[model samples]
Target: MKNKSGSFIEWLIPFCFILCAGWLIWHLPAFTLDWVPPDQSQADNLRGLHHRNDVTPGMSGPFGGEADWVDYLALLGLPIFLYIGIRTVRRAPMEFESWRPADRVSVFIGRVTMMMIILLTSVMLYEVLLRYVFEAPTLWANELSLWLAGFVFLCAGLYAMQQRSHIRIFLLYDICPRWMQRLFDTISTVLIVLFAFFLVYGGYGEALDKLWRWETFGTAFDPPIPATLKPTVLIIVSLVAIQAVVNLISDWNAEPVIHTAADDIDQDELEKIRAAVGAEGVGDLDVTRGSIQGNQTERN
Candidate 1:
């Protein structure tokens, strides 16, 4: 039953993404064009120059002015995609060091970050090809890549926190008593939460204003980077704080762990390499297979 459910979700997510992507592509002309002026034939709006308010009546339909079946489908697919992203990551092996509900959320965001990175790369490559090979560079590609890159950076930070891979000096932590370790964890979590709080509190007004005005980048493409990213920064930071608290709670009773220089090594990755190269080949390469074996034996 578990495998069957996983198979279903695996198929469903891609199908839903394709549906959404197709919907976006179908509306690409509308999205890229300047909003049609009130008296103008919608034909003249293709310069893609205007802001949100200048969108044509036809284009405005998706934003609640009028209803379309495809628009509804796209809207419904998004939350389903988000749900599946969370669910799928929960069932997968941990690529990082931790596991929790918050970790699941962060991993899902990491998956999204991966997709955005791919999209950004594709856009840049497309622009390069167009500019160098076809001599017809696009105005929108650069702005769109920038927009995707920003989200990728934000999402990566959240994922890094969940993985416990963010920078830390554990020299003192390794020597501390378990109680002291818990105390240190609590202090760090509190500090993170407080920083997120002050950031949101101090910037809420300006973020809200930018969003309300639907601010856009001043480029010819004029993507809504400022409007969306300002609020997103606050949101992602808040999520990071929540994830920190979750990490603290999850690790509250975990056994005390000793840290050392060897802790920096990724045993899983080394094992993968050892498997690929075989025991004899690994020995020939002097790949520290013996040390890894010793560590595993000691842990057991």
Candidate 2:
């Protein structure tokens, strides 16, 4: 068991990442809202809730908060993510093998999203406890969960690219010649980049404007969710764009992973089924294999 111990080097790099993220969040004026008196800040708009002051003309979205809950939750959550990232790297180096610098960023953000999921669950539990057990409810819980969930959805796209887990029509793709395969990859990546470019280009100014003006959500618990979330749209798509480009470059020279009729079959899986039913070995599956071949012949 002593051999299982990890050295400081295993965690050092991830620790530095978490530390830098924490320091930056701590220094941001928006997150510093905790230090200021609640009454003085937009957070103080609670208690009465429905006044025209809280729900102004058009600052916030449907939820109505002044700032994102992530500003507060990130400090606590990012370290957990960093720790997970370090462990993942140590345990599954192949997952990140051949990763470029930008790929690492997407992986980091993806890991953070996992941690955020846990925190989001906790927030829901806390809200339930407060509302039922304590007979008190928070104005922020509903809005905060939505805000966190939105980011999780947005960031997962980048993560899927990093993992190469997105859906694809491998039936046609695998049958294509090597040159055609590269052409397909190139075309897919170009389309993704163009889509990302248009999204960022169309939304960048408004999103930045909302964040810069410190826009409010016009709710009693008023958080800056609109300002933060809008900008995140541009940011997340940009990361996805970068990850797409990285994938194209990194996979350009990858050996073709051709799929065959036999490759589509699962011999090991059939063996597992056979064993589960008390078969002695794959030799007991003679009929099964024959039946499969017969079916394929009929299909052809």
The candidate that achieves the highest TM-score relative to the unseen native structure: 1
lDDT of 2 by residue, 1-300 (tens): 011224454455455454545343323433323343244534433222223323232343232343234443555566665655544543233243545767667766665666677768999999999999999999989987887788789888888888786877688898889999999999999999999999988998998667554566777766567767898888888888888889889999999986566654567676677776456433544677667777999999
| TM-score list, all predictions | 0.75, 0.62
Candidate 2 total steric clashes: 7
- Model 1 RMSD vs true structure: 8.0
Instruction: Give all candidates' CA lDDT scores.
Output: 0.71, 0.65
| Model 1: residues with Cα > 4 Å off, grouped in runs | 1-69, 91-94, 276-300
Clashes of 1: 3
Q: Model 2 Cα displacement at 64 (Å)?
A: 31
lDDT of 1: 0.71
Stretches > 4 Å off in candidate 2: 1-97, 258-300
Worst window of 10 by summed lDDT in candidate 1? 46-55
Q: By TM-score, how accurate is candidate 2?
A: 0.62
**Best lDDT goes to which candidate?**
1
